[model samples]
Structure formats: structure tokens, C-alpha cells
Target: MAKNELHIALVGNPNSGKTSLFNALTGLNQKVGNFPGVTVDKKTGSIRLEENFDAELIDLPGTYSLYPRRADEWVAYKVLMGADADIKPDMVLLVADASNLKRNLLFCSQIIDLKIPVVMALTMTDIAAKKDIQIDINGLEAELGIPVVTVNPRKNKGLTELKKVLAQASRMNQNLHARDFMNTKKLAPESVEGVQKLFPQLSEYAAIHYLINHENFPLSDLDQKAVEQVETVNKFNPNKTQAEEILQRYTRIRQIMQQHVVEHGPLEKKMFTEKLDNILLHRTWGYVILLAVLFLLFQSIFWLAQFPMDGIEWLFTKAGGWLSTTLPQAWWSDLIVNGLVAGLSGILVFVPQIMILFGLITVLEDTGYMARISFLSDKLMRKAGLNGKSVMPMISGFACAVPAIMSARNIENKKERLLTILVTPLMSCSARLPVYTILISLVIDDKYYFGFLSVQGLVMMALYFLGTFMALIVSYVMKFFIKIKEKSFFILELPIYRAPRWKNVGITMVEKAKIFVFDAGKVIIMISLLLWFLSSHGPGNRIEKVEQKYALLAQQHPAQADSLQKPLSAEKLQNSYAGILGKAIEPVIEPLGYDWKIGIALITSFAAREVFVGTMATLYSVEETDDNSSLRQKMDAATHEDGSKVYTLPAALSLMVFYVLAMQCMSTLAVVKRETRSWKWPVFQFIYMTGLAYAMSWLTYVIFS
Candidate 1:
């Protein structure tokens, strides 16, 4: 290792401001990937410390303690015990919440006893002050015998001094506790001594952990046998030893707090957060507010993103026209003007909605209301055979299912986690926004019911809720089939409410929008090109024959040339390869009120739901060669051979309902496969969701037609 470079691990309890500190220190210099053999998120970043010294910071998952109740906590334990060589840290940066010192210190003290070089970074001191609490940092540092620094990462405070302290701490020798906090030898002398005989370098705390979880710990066959033998000979009682050790640690922590901390008010001060939570978490009123918040979110997705979406469409339309008139009309020119420009336009127009949605979600998180939402939904989650933690992943599925599925790793119960992963894709992600918006505009009226509420936005909200409702139903059904019998519970911390951090919110919005465009954009453009080729050519001379027929018709009647051109081109599309495939599937989907063109879009959009619009855009651009209208306009004016409208209200609604229930995105399936480590679940997921989509869509069409 370089002298200036070191590896540091960040560990703390949930809602301890650990992630905020990491974000402040790393800013946009971070990368997220999975651990070596696990699906848990591993966040690493580069940090520039004092005097040209740099460090690699790994942000471990926020865990309550080192007892390893969750998979993520086990990752932390493995690294802290120097068992995971790939991620073992040179030093540990333990973050403690000053407002809740007693609970936070329990985990901090455990880290200190691990005998690793460690520094304590105290956070939320300002919040503590609001509660009339004060901490003597110097006194606490002397008591703990480690370097301590105060930092408010949200405000970018104390970071310089923190780096300097870390640099100085790194120069010192390895941290070995000269005085033990709890004399484990007195509590379990034989057990500790027997374990230490095998690994003589084990710290007091490390030895105790081995006593509790030696079976799960990293050890070779021979080493494990020796440890088991020691445990057997020593008559180790893990439950009694763990309880005794924890009580002793808490006793010392209480003494330390009395000496180094001060409280200036009564315990129940009716703080600001409590006052706000009263209204936000009220039994009846809380549900009302949550509904209102969701309504506003969907309303804003349409109200705020409309102008930009229109502007993007107009710009692309003009660009396509310009390119067509300026360049010679050739195959490549057509590809550039029609295929690529049309696809790019379809993708870019949705960026505004994505940015707005993610920005508002980030605000919700920063203000600490997101946790309350999770808390309030725990009842409903339990009813669906999941715990409160599943709510976050389900809500996240509205953005994307890939990460939402990955987020389920924290759920300790195997059955609940698998159920969460299976049904999460049923939530309407942002990719489906374009499809719903276009279809709603095509059939639904824009007039408000009560003069202020948008009828269109209401339909959009209905589509989202429809997805969520079906997810819960599917999960309830799957619960009985997945036989893992572990119990489920929810333990969430509601952090103190604070003003929204606009900087963090802005960064999140930008990053999320970038991922949507670049990641989904790659799949969209490639599918668009493939659809273009498939729709442009047929299996034989049929495509050329159709074109010739159209040319001859236009030649004979020059006055009716413009009127005949669109139908002639539509005829050619019906004979193209894409048209043949769509026609082949048309019989299966006809009961759902879809025609061949809509069928084509459905087939192409399986790569990504958002590609539905691009497929429609390319197909329309091909059929109506002289028409330079926006996608919605073309879709709105579509008519059948007998002059009846193709996209009637019934058909439009059926399409929306189908999309709500369908599992069309291939990326989601890939993620499910990766997470479950089997092809069985993803296959079952696709069949169930698609079956439900088809059945519901058929029923909807039957009722409305």
C-alpha cells in the first residue's frame, strides 16, 4: 500500500447520518457495485486527505450492531473481523449520532474493542442542541481513548479537521486496547481462553463474537473443528455470555455519558418533529396526506413536464424536416432523419418527468418523511405477508425494478425477500410514463372534474395505484407457496425532520436522469434501429411491390397524390417483416382491442417499456412519410382501413391496463435472475404478470367497448 493511500470503512446505525457524511466527502467521486460474491450494495469513493494523503472510503451498509441479524450486517462483521480480505479496512470510521448517544455508543464501543485503528466521527450535534443536549467531545475522546471529531456533513462542517485527525491517527501504531471495557475473562473465562488458544491474537470482543457465531464465521475445516472442540470443552453458553457482555457495556456507556454529556431540559419537550409527525402520521389524516402527496407527484409529472416535452418534440420535428430537405434523400439520410431522430426524440422528451419525480422523492427523503411513510405502511405490508422494509423497495419500483429488487437483500426473511422481488416489477416505473401519457391523451379528455383537478393526471395516478394494488394481491398469493418459515418484523428509525437539502436533491435528480437516459437509452436506440429494419423490409419482393403500387397510383393521379400517399405507405408497412410478426400476434391480442400497429409496438417494447413510444414513432414515421407530427398527434389521428379510429377510448384504456400489469422489461427479468440465482423465479414472474395483463386488458376492453 502507498504511504498516502489507505482503506477506510464507514459503519454506523441506520439514520445516523453516515451516508450524508460519505456523500459530502466523496461528492460525485463515488461508484456503486456489488460485493465480491454478494448482491448487497458496496459503495466506494476516493478521498483527498491532509498533506497529499489520499484514501479509499467504503461506505458499508447502515447496520444497527455487529450481531449480524441481516445479510448486510454480516458483510460489515466479515470486514471488521479481518475475515473478508477483499474489503478489510486499514481503519474504521465509526459514525455516532450525538442526539442519541446511548444507543449509538453501543455499536461504537464494539468497534473500538475490535482493536482496529479507529476514529469516531460525531454527527447531528446541531440536532442534539435543538433538543437542549450538549456533549463534551474532548472528555468523551479521552474516555474512549480514540481520536474524535465533530462533523455536520449536510452543512459541510468540520471536514477539514476530521481529515487532519484521520491523517494523524494513521501515523500512529495499530490500535490495541490496553484497558478492556468489559473483562470477558471474568464473564466467560474458559470460553474466551479456549478460543484464544487457537488464534492467540484475538481481541476480547472478537473472541466473544466467535463464541456467539463461530459456526457462521470464516474458518477452515480444521480451524472450525478446533473452535467447536474448544466450545464443547469450555461449556460455552452463548445466550448468557452475550447478555452479560451487553449489560456490562451499557453500564459503562451510561457512566461515560454522565461524565461527558449534559441535558438542559425535560425528556419530553414536544419537539418540532413530533409536532409535524402528529399530523403526518395521524391514523386517518396520515393516509389522506399520503394520498394527496402521491396525487401531487403524478400531477406534477404531467403539469411540469408538458412544456419541455412539447418543446423537445417540436425541436426534433424541425430537425428531422431540416435534415430531410437539406441532405440528399438516401437510405442513410432516411435512417438519420427518421429512425434515429425519431427514437432520440422519444427518449429525450421524458427526461423532464424523470428529473421532476426523482427531485421530489429526494426532497421527501431529505425531510425525513420517507421513513414515516415506510412506518405507516407497515400494517399494510404485514397484511401482504411482508414487513415495512419491503415498502421502500416497492416504492422504489416506481422508479425502476432492477435496483428495487436489489434493495430487498436487507430483508432477513427469505420468503418475504423473494415475494418482494417477484411482485416489485408490477409497480409502474418511470419507463411506462411515456406509454401511459400517450395513451391517456389519445383517449381520455383533458378537462377537470372539479375545475382544478386534471382528469388526465387522475388517470395516470389510477394506473400507478392499479400496479401497486396488483403487486400486493400477487404477494399475498405467493406467500403461501414460498415455504420458508422465518418470522418477519419491521424496525425503522424516524430521523429528526430537517429542511430539504437542495444540493443533495439536485445531485440525485441529475444522476437518476442520467441513468434513465444512458442506460435505458442504449436499449431504446438499438431496438428502434432493429424495428426500423424489420419494418422497412419484408421477407421477399412484397415490400418492393407495395412501393411500386403506391408510385404508380401517385403517377396516375398527381392531383390526389398527397391524399393517396399515406394509405399507400401504410399498405407497405403492413407487408413489411415487422408488420408480419405483428399480424401473427394480432389474433392473440385482438380480444384486448389492439390492432396490428399496437401489436408491433408491444413486441418491440419487451426490451424496455419506454421503447413502446419509440416503436410507435418509428412505425408512424415509416407509414406517414410526409407527416412530421409529434408522436401523440400521429397516434391520435390513426384510422383503420374502413376509416374508423384505431385508438378508441376502449382500446386506449385496455392498452394502459395491459401495461400496468405486464412484465415487459427484459432488464427487470435479468436482475431477478441475478438476485434469485435461478431461472425459475423470473420465468414464473413473466408468465404470471403477462397472464394477468392479458386477462385484465381483455376484461377492460369488453366492459368499455
Candidate 2:
């Protein structure tokens, strides 16, 4: 690659606006994936420099210092240490928050000691100014011997200057003065020199890091032994060296800050964040406020999505009706109208609800209240054998368990992180919404509880609570069995509250909706097509026999043929391949108030929970000739062989409770395998959740029956 076609590593602390800056620089030119052999998200984007040169920017995970305490932080450390060959950067773009420069400088100084070329992009300058603080950029640059560009990525400021600085810094033949920031040679000269002799290319700081993290770094056995010998000869204690080095670095940082920065405001005055936290983080009222927020979120998801959902359903119903009459009455027509159309409608109708839930979550995250939630839920989380950070993933689990399980990488303790991943799927993701909605509408009355609150809304809230309460109970039980020796701790940074960036929130909503539609929709559509075929054809000519019998009846009673058509179609369905499988499982699920029709839906819907609605739609469409009726309408009119109602209150409620606890999604299992890196956990997770769902559902059925 040319010098101008450089690779820049974007590194920073958590919540330091590093991601915002990256979005500004890259715009829509970015892709997210996992790093090689790890589940940590590796984000890369491209930007044009001066209309001719292009740069690839890698956004590494956020961290506090060179020493890593977690999996993600270790990625950042490895990349900066040149231990990662796949992502060696020509230059580092260190993003720092001006408002918290003192803490941010700790990581910045550590990066500078790595001997790589770096340009500082200082963000949050406006916030610092609002607090009556002033930073002399020229003085800090001269002191640190690097270029510093103050920027507000949210406002799209200083980006041009940032690119120009990056271009100049990348082309420098002579390296930047890395030791001018902090000299580790002064802390442990003998150990550093001894390790440097072995590596030959390592800087003094790199040599020191190698000594401290030799176990973690990628090194040959011979080189590792040599490093260990040096450590033994020098009597180098890793902990003591780290503490002394941090103290010395801070002493130097204070002198630099005093000379180059100024604060005009009183340091002891309470800021707006503290004042808001006084109430938002109150001991008694904090939990109440959190509950209120969750109630509003769930209420808005249901209320705001109702109209769009109705519109989508109406549109699909009209389309299906038109296809039924307009298309030639053939098997392919049935596939398109009853299979593809029905399945697509089933997935699309839930997009509005998914978008709303994710959009609200993005806003909560942007305003930094998400962190406060972690803080508030810390005590409760610990009682469930997790720390505060586990709450964020659990909350995110409400959106989807796949990413929620991935988000547990931040939890340092092995036991707590594993527990969080195991219980997160029980939080009732949006995939279950369609199942809940169709079942609730079928059985529950939609009346007002206090002349204000909708009964349906209260039930929705109760279902969420049921999932969460079960998750907590499960975690508390698993805590004693999954033994680990590592201690758990929670350290959270509460960001200053600000107006949410609408653009980011909008992007998040659109992205999440797309993932749901495209990723999950593919599996649902394929299964729906296969299901149509399986339900349309059967072995041993049973379908032909049913058709012949119906034909003879039509000739004998022409007037009653119209009524006989439905039963004729039902007879053919019962003999079809799909119906045979449902009948095979009927004995197991019969006590749950389910017939073979509902049994077919339960079997096919193992692909996804939302597919339950589509399965019902297709099955009913195959049996009934009416094309204009909605899914709920068709299901409501369904009956048993004895002409008794199939979907009673007990059955509907039992189904809802079953879905709340069921691990029916194959995609979730795939993700668990990827995150946990073993089929053991996913298999174990499936059996346990399935068994739990069956027991609970049976209990619900018996009580209501």
C-alpha cells in the first residue's frame, strides 16, 4: 500500500465519542464483523483523504490503559503492541475526551510509549468549555510532541483538519518522539533492556509490556523462556512495576496539565450530571423510575405499532385475496399466496414493533442513561449472581439474545458472564411478539382495567416481567453450580446527559429492522414453502383417496358440497406429511388443549417463534377456501373433529406461557454456539429451556382447564 493509502487504528476509552468520530469520518462506508478467532466486534471503515488518497480505519475496542483486564481490552492491547499481524496500522488516531482529559490522558500516554506514529483527535471540547475549562492545544502538542486536533464529531467539526493531520503524520519518515510523553526506561531499566536484547525490535515500553503480559502475548516457547529468565534475573515483580509506573506517569501528567491547561470554574461545584443523579440514582426512587421507564417502553412498543401492524396485515390480506381469485388455481399459486405471502406478512408485521423497541433503546444509550441503569441495577444483578455490567446485556436481551450474549464480553468474571449469556435469552425478545399478539387476541378480552389502562397492555407487561423474573431465578440457581475463582467488580462511567443525536437513533432503528427482516425472514420463508408442500402431499395416495371420496359426496349432495369442501380439505390435510408428523406428537401435547392443527404449527415454528402465526395462516388457508379472512379470524373459526373450539382460553394462555420460556429459535442456538465456542452449551441450553417450557405450559393448561 502507498503511504497515503494508510491504515489507521482508532483507539480510545469507553464513552469517549470514539465511535461518533468514526461515524463522522466514515459515514456509511463501514462494515462490522468479529476479529479473527474472537467474538469481539471488529469495525472497519474507509475514508477519502484529499480526494486522491484513501485510508482504512479500524475501530478497536475501548480500554482504559495498556494493561488489559477484559477480552475486548486485550484486543486493543494486542493490536497496539504489534502482536496482531492481521491489523497492523501505519498510524494510530487516538480519540480523547477533552472534558475528562486527566483520565483519557492515561491511555493516550500509554499508546504514545508504543513507538507508533499517532495523531490525537480531542473530542468533547464544547462540553469542557461549558464547564469553564480551557486547553492550550499548542502547549499540549509541544509538551507531548504530537499533533492535537480539537473536534466535535457530533457537530461534524474539525474533520477536514483531522484528515490533513492524519495524512501528514502517516507520511513522516522519522518516527514521532514516543518517549517524550512517558519514558518507561526510567521505571525498570534492567528488565526492559534484558527483554529488548531478546526481541531486538521492541521499544522500552513494549519490552516492559511483554514482561508483564508474556503469558498473554503471542510468543514462541524459546522467546518466552528467555523473557522469563530475564524477569527472574532482574527480580521484576509485575504488580509492583505496574503500580510504580502508573504513579510516575501521573506525576509527569500533572506537571504537563498544570502548564498547558486552565480551569476557570470552581472545582467543587456540583454539575448538572450530579444534580440529575441525585434523583435519577436515588436509593428509593431509582427503582421506581426504572420501572416507569420500562412500562413506558413496552406500552409505546405496543401502542405505536398497532396502527402500522394493522395496515400491514390489511394490505397482505387484500393481496392474498386478490391472488386467490386472480391467479390460476394451481399448486404454484397456492405456494405463492398461502406460503410466501403469508410468511412475509408474518415477519413484516412485527418490524414496526422491533424498530420501536430498538429506537427507544438507542435513545436511552445515546443519552447515557443506559449506564445509569446498569448502576441502579447493580445490587439486584448481584443477587442474581451477576454484576452491574450484566444488566446492560440483560436489558439488551429484551431486543435480541444473539447480540446480548455477545455484549457479555465486557464482563470480566467468567462465571458472571456465562450466567448472563445463559439467562439473557429468557428476557423475551421481539420475535415472540407475534405469537403473544395472536394468542392474546384470540383468548384475552381487550378491556380497560381502571378505565385508563388497557387489559392487553397489562398482560404484555406481565409477560415481560414473567420472562425477567424467570431469568433472575434461573441465574440465582445456576450461580452455585458454575464454579469460578475470579472475583467480580463493576466500574461504570456515567456520561453527561445530552440531547440524543437523531441521525444515530434513526440509523440504529433501520439497521436492526433490516437484520430482523433479512436474517430471520430467510429461514421463515424457506420453511413456509417446505411446509406448504408437506401439508399438500401425502404418502400411500391418501390425498387421492380423500379427493375421490369428496367428489362422490359432491355428486350425491350438490347442495351440501359448499359445506363439504372445508371438511374435504381438512381430511386431505390430516393425511398430508405435515399432518402425519403433528399426529405423531399429538399424544404428548394433547393435555395442553392442542389438536393436530396446532401441533403442526408447533412443529414448523421451531425455525422461529414468529413463524407460529405464519404456520397458522398457511395451514388454515390450505384447509379453508376463504382468502380474505385474517389469520386471527381463521384461527378463531377453527374446531376439533367433534366440532368443539380448539383454541380455548386455557390453550391460548398455555401457548403464550410456553413461548415465554421456550428456546424455539434455531438462530439463537447458532449464536450461542458461536459466542460460547461449543455445542455443549447450546445443546444444554435447548434441553433445559424446552423442558422448562413444557412443565410450565402443562401447569398453566391444567389450572385453566
Which candidate wins on lDDT? 2
Instruction: List TM-score per model, in order.
Output: 0.88, 0.90
Residue 589 displacement (Å), model 1: 1.9
Q: Candidate 2 on 109-139: residue-level lDDT in tens?
A: 8888888888899999988987877899999
- Per-residue lDDT, model 2, residue 144, is 85
Computed on alpha carbons, the lDDT of every model, listed in order, comes to 0.83, 0.84
Compose the digit string of candidate 1's lDDT tens values, residues 81-120: 8778688688999999999999999888888877888898
Clashing pairs in 2: none
TM-score of 2: 0.90
Clashing pairs in 1: none
Kindly report which residue stretches of model 2 are placed more than 4 angstroms away from their true locations once superposed: 1-4, 264-268, 307-349, 396-412, 437-460, 514-526, 529-533, 547-565, 617-649
